[model samples]
Target: MENIRLGGGVLLLVLLAVTSLFVGVIDVTLQNLVDTTSRPQALQTLAESRIPRTLALVLAGSSLAVAGVIMQMLARNRFVEPSTAGTVEAASLGMLLMLLVFPGAPVVVKMLVAALFALVGTALFLRLVRRIPPYSPLLVPLTGIMLGAVIGSLTAFIAYRTNLLQSLGAWRNGDFSLVIAGRYELLWLTFVLAVAAYFAADRFTIAGLGGDVSRNLGLDYDKAMAIGLAIVAAVSAIVVTTVGSIPFLGLVVPNLVSLAIGDNLRRGLPWVALTGALLVLGCDIVGRIIVHPYEIPVGTVFGVLGGAIFLFLLLRRSSRVS
Candidate 1:
């Protein structure tokens, strides 16, 4: 049954990806796919815009999903992921700092700096969570959100003070419109991080059971957490640097997978990846189709749509418990 659900999710993701091919600000007809000379506009749209956007969507989705799974396991809280934990906000701050310090640094250099700060932020988050009593799983996310808000506010203040608000807009809004051959290279880094995530899945699952249980089971709890934090930071950095902050992706996708397939990380990772890809790609497609000539940012769509879904889930869970 788990395999069936997983397979279904994968199928949905593929369908979404294919649908993404058809969706664009410009209308692309079937004849356009066949006759390049006749439909030069369509050909250019598919080759330049749709393809890169689709790649960005898939990479962002899978990376964020996997980051969420690792983060939730490390924190022993389903709701604690990079976005909630201030990792993404910290990365944005790092990029801002790099910009301020260097004045004209390349994107790669900025991304590395952002990634380092993100790691630090995640480590701080884990330390904060450890200090808090774990009885209230809900409090974990609340604390994380508080931490993130603080960081986000600081970022906004800096951007405002530095008069870099326009520069920051690119990172604040998650859009794949800028992705191209040279620019999109960073997203592939997420693929490497995803592979590493799978290798450490067992340790994460053990750690999630609690530090004491993991220690008793002969797993290095601290080491596992450090590794998890690194993965979360790296993944969050890559996604934010590549496509900007995608709010609620890490929170929504993995939790949805957990609902369908228990809490087993190994068993649930694939589904999480697929569902993340599907959700983001589908949202991107919808955003493209809705505005016709202009495109809505994927982050905005996810913010509104994912928020509603999250609220529904919270309500449903509350009712079930009641």
Candidate 2:
């Protein structure tokens, strides 16, 4: 059954990707790639824009979801994700700083700076989590959301003052319309990190068992956590830098996967990755077709859906507790 579902999900993703390639203002078709008689413009759009956008979607969706799983494992809270935990906001701040200081720096440099900020942000969130009593799982996410808001406010203020508010808004609003061959390559770093997370899945699952358990099992609990945070930070930074912020993507996708499967990171990780990609692809497709000729940002679509799902999850948890 699981294999069937996985296969179906992959099939759906492939279909959506193909659909995405041809959905833009200027129509493109697979025939454009093979036929010498086809319009050169179609082939140019496919190679330069559509293909890169599709690849960015896959990389961003999968990596962000995997990052969320790793974060949940490290934080011992299913609700905590890169966006919720202030990592995304921190990365935004880092990018803002980079824009203010080194506006001409290469994309790689911006990503590195953003990632460093994310690491600090994740560390701070973990510190706050440690200080809080773990009586309610909701508390951690609420704290994280608040933390993210504070960071986001700071980023906004700086952007506003610097006359870069529009730039900041563009970065905050996740859209792939601008993605092209040269622009989205930073996301490959996220792909590498996601693969690394798969290999270290066991350590993450053990770490989720808590510090004492991990230490007793001869795992360096702090080291495992540091590595996980670094991975999450890197993924967050790369995705935000490449395609902007997609809210609740990290939070919603992983929880849905965990609810369907279980918290076994190794077993559920691939499903989480696939589901995330599918969800994002579906949302992007809807965003494209809903307005027809115009488009809504994919982040806007996921924000609404993810927020509703998040509310439902919270209510369901509350009901179970009650």
Candidate 3:
């Protein structure tokens, strides 16, 4: 039954991805691919724009969901993710700083800088969580939110002062309209990191039990944490640097997958990835057609959906506790 469901999900994702290829304004079709004359433009659109954008949707979706699950493991809090934990905000700040300081820097340099800041920000959030004598799940995410807000404010103020607010806004909001073949390659790095996370899942799960417990179980808790945070940072940075942040993605997908499959990260990870890709692809497709010639950003569409889901989750949790 489980296998059946998983297979169904994969099929759904494949169909959605196919649907995504044909939904863009340029109107790519199989007929275009078959006909000798129309093949050139259709192939160009698919190769240059549609395919890259679709790949971006899948890569970003799966990787962000994986990163979210890893973060939840490290924090032992379901609500904590890159966005809430200041990781994404810090990464965005790093990119902004790079753009300001070294306007001529390569994308690689900006990505590296953003990853560094993300690592530090994620580390700080974990450290703050550790300081609490007895941690509360609610409090952990709230603290992270506050930390992210502070980092975001600093980033915004810098952009304001430098008169680069427009540039900052572009990188801060998740939008894939501009993605093309050469541009979105960075997200593949994120996919590789997500795959690596699967291998490290057991250690991360043990480590999430807390330092002393994981040590007694013969796991190097610090190493596990470092690996986890590095993955998170790199994933967050790559996404931000390449296509801007997708708010609540890392949060919503993981929580939803966990609710369905339980928090066994290793077992549920693939489903999380598939579901995420399906979701983002579906959302992007909807955004493309919902307004016809003028398309809405996938970020905007998913942000609205994810926000409503988040509120529902929060209220449900509160009610359960009461």
Candidate 4:
């Protein structure tokens, strides 16, 4: 049954990728894709724009998804992803700072700033977790959400002060239309980070057991945590920088995959990556189809559906605990 479910999810994801190629703001169809004798403009658009944008989405989606799973394991909770844990907001703040302080800085410089902020944010969240009482796992995400809200508000204030509210809003809402050949290269960094994550999967699983147990097992708990935080930060900053803030890709993808496969990252990591890419691709396709000429951002679609699912899970867990 589990294998069947995984296989089904993979199939759905592939369908989404294929469908995405067909649907877009422009009138692109199979005829356009197949017509080798078509106008030069059609081929130019596909080769330059659509293909890179779609590939960027697939890469970003998978990277963020795996980052979420690693984060959850390190934090020992299913709900504490980068979005909930303030990493995305922190990265946004960094980007805002870059644009404000050094308006002419390169994209690479901006991304580095964002990565630094995200790493610090992840560190802060972990520090807070260590200080909090361990009895309630529910409080972890709650604390994280509160932290994110506070950071988000700060980001808003800065945007308002700098007179960059519109640009910041675009960044927060996240649109992939900006993705093109030169810009999309940053997203590939997430793929590298994901590969590094696979190598450290066992250590993450061990660290999830608890600091004392991890130490007893001869693993350096703090070092393992730092590594995890670094991975989360790198993956998250790249996603935020490449596309913008995607609210629930990190949270939803990992959780859904974990539901199908077990929690062991070694066993479940590949499926998590596959499922993550699928979900984002499918959502992107839906966004393109629903709005027609003007498209809704993938983040918005995920926000509506993902928020409802997150709420349902929260309520269900509460009921079970009580």
Better of 2 and 4 by lDDT: 2
lDDT of 1 at 308: 90
lDDT (10s digit) by residue, model 3, range 214-280: 9999998889999999999999999989888888888889889888889888899998889888888
Candidate 3 ranges with C-alpha deviation above 4 Å: 133-135
| Model 4 regions lying over 4 Å from their true place | 1-11, 34-39
Q: Write the per-residue lDDT of candidate 2 for residues 1-322, one digit (tens) a residue.
A: 9889889988998999999889978867677756787768888888899899999999999999999989888899878898899999999999999999999999889999999999999999999999888896788999999999999999999998999999888778789989999999888888899999999999999999999999999999988998999999999998888889898888888889878888788889999889888888889989999898999999999999999998898888889999
Scored against the true structure, residue 204 in model 2 reaches a CA lDDT of 92
Number of colliding residue pairs in each model:
0, 0, 0, 0
lDDT of 4 by residue, 248-298 (tens): 777777777777666878878888898788877877878877878778898
* lDDT of all predictions: 0.84, 0.90, 0.90, 0.85
Ordered list by TM-score, greatest first: 3, 2, 4, 1
**Ten-residue stretch with the least lDDT total in model 2:** 26-35
* lDDT agreement of model 3 with the native: 0.90
Q: Compared with the true structure, what per-residue lDDT tens digits does model 1 show for residues 1-322?
A: 7677667877777788778878765677788778767588887877787777788899888889899989888887767778888898899999889888986888778888898999998888888898887566678888889998899899889999999987677787798877765677788888888888888889989988888899999999889888888888888888887889888888888888888778878777877888888888988887887988788989999989888977887788679777
Better of 2 and 4 by TM-score: 2
Residue pairs with backbone overlap in model 1: none
Best by TM-score: 3
